[model samples]
Target: MTRGLSRRALLGGTVGGLALTTALTGPAATTATAATAATAATKTAGAGSRRGAVGPEPYVPVAVGAGGGPAGTDRVHVLKIGPDTAHTVLVLVPGMFGAAGDFRLLARDLVAAVPGVQVWAFDRREENLADRTGFATPDPAGYYLDGHYRSQDPTAAAYTAGWGLARTLDDLDTVVRMAACGGRRRVVLGGHSWGATTAMTYAAWDFDGRPGYRDLAALVVVDGGVRGAFKGTGQPVSDSPEQVRERLAAIDGGAVFDMTLSGVGLGSRAESTQIWYQLAGWYAHHDPAGRSVLQPRLPDALRPSSPLTNAGLLGTLVDVGFGWPNDISVHSGHLADADADGVRGWVDTGITPMSRVAAAYAGGPQPAVWEWYWPSRLSVDLDVADPYVDTDLARSLGLRLWHAEALDTPLYAFQTSYAKGTIVSGARDVVTNSRIPYGTYETDNGMTHLDPLFADTPHNTLTRTLAPFLTALR
Candidate 1:
């Protein structure tokens, strides 16, 4: 039976976890960071893991560190692959707490179906959860958890254990250079969710002269939002941290919805899973209503999906660090302002922060299935209190910001008709914000956060689709 795709929401705001790392030596480190991640059993947890969903014989690849850099620059791992020949080399980047395996279909499809292209999904920087355990110290780097940002100056050093954006981009630069087949085979640089944000950031960084960050046929962004300065409003906020909390208390029916990496101190990976579990539960419950409209673009197969193993999840969230303005639930004002020309937008949405109590009832399944393999107590910092309040790291990451950068929408408008670049977006995605024609600056074929991956779902379609796009690049 051809099972229909499930209706899983994107990461559903559940941040696996993250912090910061310093081992970003060079392009080799970038290459090494994501190169040797342990590849899991494909059939166990892959793109087709959704219930009743059946199709390809679960594509997997065994990727070992073939050769690159000096003798022992980094280690190598393997991936599971079915039967196919790859002509194009794909460097798949995952968002916070994400792994190389995350890009199952994109990699599989492009490698298998997309003729003459070898797509290799990568496990980007600082995802290693080997060192620290049981809390971070209360230092400047420790207490500076801002809003959950996929692509921004990473401030969650103490919050989790992820790599810095600059390092990740740099690592990617070298990985592509080292593992790349050179001009013989074209390369496609792509990121999923925060991974896409990293892609855009890396693109900008490359344009800014980041070493090893170069030469790509095209960029593929799977269901990601643009972050920067706001466009319309330029006013500063009036509320303090306390004021922000109070604002949430006064929300209609005492409800607060937040999907930030903020406030997650030292707890079990359960808390990490709890975050998304609850959020996904919320989305699944609220899907009938128009409130959770942002997630409709997810592949139908993913909607009914179960929680993924929390193995390297924390490593993912720590990279971005926890902290955010209350914008996910309420109409946010963060990205409300943008010049589009200069990459600034308006922050009009008015989101609210969450209370300790609210998150409990709202969270979804806190799976303990992989406790044996992934471990339970990933990290903890009960000692590190907020500068203002003596709460946990969650509260520490939770600081209400007054100003944020809006994105420059039309900035990329010049890419099209000139460079073979076409924009991919879901109409329902709030990241598109209030475009005049509503997401038509480039090739806004109505894509959302999850649209970047789900080829066919609602207003979520990618004109540049992965396979052919990377194939043509060569």
Candidate 2:
């Protein structure tokens, strides 16, 4: 079952209900922050045990270093795979609020399919738990009271300010250099979702004519390297510094967009399942009134009834992260056992964040299942905080304002013609405006945003698609 949702439904609203009140409290809104986070959570409890959703092999940590902050306390982590004899390397970046584990399918397949070619993934300093409505401090354990993001140094540092796009690019540069091993290793930079944006930002950054990390290889954007500037609900926002500042300010203070409405953040597992069931009714059964099928009541004290409307769920589920590209949800065995089994499991529909909560409620909270997958905890501070309008990084990245001279590197992008999102359109604009040596601007048929990431077999669809293009890289 494949379905296409209207762009309006997909780009819901920016501020969630709880986020509004928190942003109103100003920067010193720590007290309100906790309540807001609690509200964002479908269920809650005391601290749970630390566990990994993915196993401890193939994906090995290559380097561990300190992340930049006032305290320099946050930890930076990088993982890699491929034979040492390999000359070419592909470095992948995860999307916003996405962890390194999400790329397990792509990384594993790349190593097996491509001979002597290495694949690497990094857990960005930005991939941290929200600290009182901001990033800079990582609270992976405290976020769910379970130590999921093990790379986070709990005692490392405290939040001083936002980690801007420049720092994020620097982190990517460091990872690239590490992967190169002090020598000029042929490297291709690619990213999924927001990571694609990060990769594009890295490619666009002016390296001052130095060829350390900026040597010619190729820029691979998988579904998200677009300069989605000034995209808002109801109307397109103007690309103005004042507008950007106001947007970031709202998020920094504490603005939460309803996940259901925003078509971004995920509700609890129960909520997700409710969302899935509702989607199944519409796409599977073709019900015109499928919008109100399976509305699940949640445990959040204030907004107990899930804000997830049938209209929003219908669109969000078709997205790569939230649901399968194909609208149908398969009964893929017991998904909750993945954490204990140490196996990568596909998160089927009907398993929302509340699934863990329900299990925890019935029994003790089971170990964090599906290490490979995590629900998005949309942070006003980290995820959508930076409205990239007229910022220095935005200019360097060729985001809002394109710089043709700055973008002289080779660029290749795979965008589905059915894409109603910013990535494809943005890529086209960037290619048109910049001096990017056009490589492959291929459009795939019937592939959803995540089809390139979550291909499940050894003969992976994504790796196979990129093989010919990557092989021809000079």
Candidate 3:
């Protein structure tokens, strides 16, 4: 797996910059070509034409979830871009509250980078849109309930990791079939946060009826969306939001602490809001546009929550084992470098976890499935030997419900010292200390939670330091 922004101006410089922008409004041949190329590029590249910075709009939703029978809570919207009949398809899974819109810049770059290829993004069914629309939830427990077949409740009943894992793999399998119907042969499964886990899980784990698990060309796990910390390795724990919170019980940290407290494993919607607000504010200092990117996703109900407060965000992160406390400062461990100052501040904050990440990186032939965002509870455990449901389907479905250790096998554990290839990345600002899951024991300092999605970011350094590693896929 290969893991993987901008700045503002001086107050006085903005006026001059605006005047320059206004004066250059002439549509000459160069501008015309740029526009033409951009348009052609979008059609060739699969850029969504959505408003704002997220490139062109998304492809007409061809089918909801692969074979088209909706598999998720959110209809899996799939869009295919490109005319190449026999091409490699990149299946993208977005993070929580993330939509196809999140891949704007990355899709454009990928289209331009890899010729004869298509990129597809899906909206998984995990979230309940009804809360926003004032409609009642279709399934009150929403698929992750304790007694449900997908639930990771062994003591409560029995384990079902397999159920949850199967759900994700099957979703991808459906998408793969739908995309394959159009004739794409090779597939690159890519995901961020929870999406990444789905992508990787599908990669390594075999789908019940799906054929050609061997046909997978690559896997991109962004941050440990699964069973462990940011790196993703370590025994999986079914730590509740409060339990995780308690682990990092200490506060009194600075900006880093504040960042973690504001954004990590907050159980309720209220906690997430507070952390996001702080992030929106902190990120605002660098970009003139501020964190408007958050406005679209951050619920209006959370407008009152203050995210900048240090304790809540950082404290929450520590407890969840996501954003780590600085080994040196022991205060906080999250930062962004979309802008010059942000980058500088990040560089100065403390030792980059990547730089000091000590791990043994050797592994074996590896499981085909690669789970990026590991589940916290045993939701549906496939690997476990339990009596919840005798059939395999029941356990497979459970993998989706809880965070389990087995899910992060290939990516986090050193069980694959002999394997020739692996795909992994973690975001720097991940609320989940997800990096561990990315490497069996080896750490890619270049990776951060979002690095795989943001080409310019540090996490997906493979795109930068080892372009051939990816481009060769062509």
> Which candidate has the top score in lDDT?
2
Candidate 1 wrongly placed segments (more than 4 Å): 1-85, 130-162, 206-213, 225-271, 274-448, 451-460
Q: Model 1 TM-score?
A: 0.39
TM-score on alpha carbons, each prediction: 0.39, 0.55, 0.44
Off by over 4 Å in 2: 1-73, 128-160, 207-213, 227-239, 251-406, 421-425, 458-461
lDDT of 1 at 178: 45
User: What 10-residue stretch in candidate 2 is worst by lDDT?
Assistant: 363-372
Q: Across residues 42-63, which tens digit of lDDT does each residue of candidate 3 receive?
A: 3322222231122333444332
The clash tally of candidate 1 reads: 105
For model 3, the run of ten residues with the poorest summed lDDT: 359-368
lDDT of each: 0.29, 0.42, 0.33
Candidate 3: clashing residue pairs, number: 122
Please give the lDDT score for candidate 2: 0.42
User: lDDT tens digits, residues 352-390, model 2?
Assistant: 232222221121011110111122222221223233223
Model 1 poorest 10 in a row by lDDT: 368-377
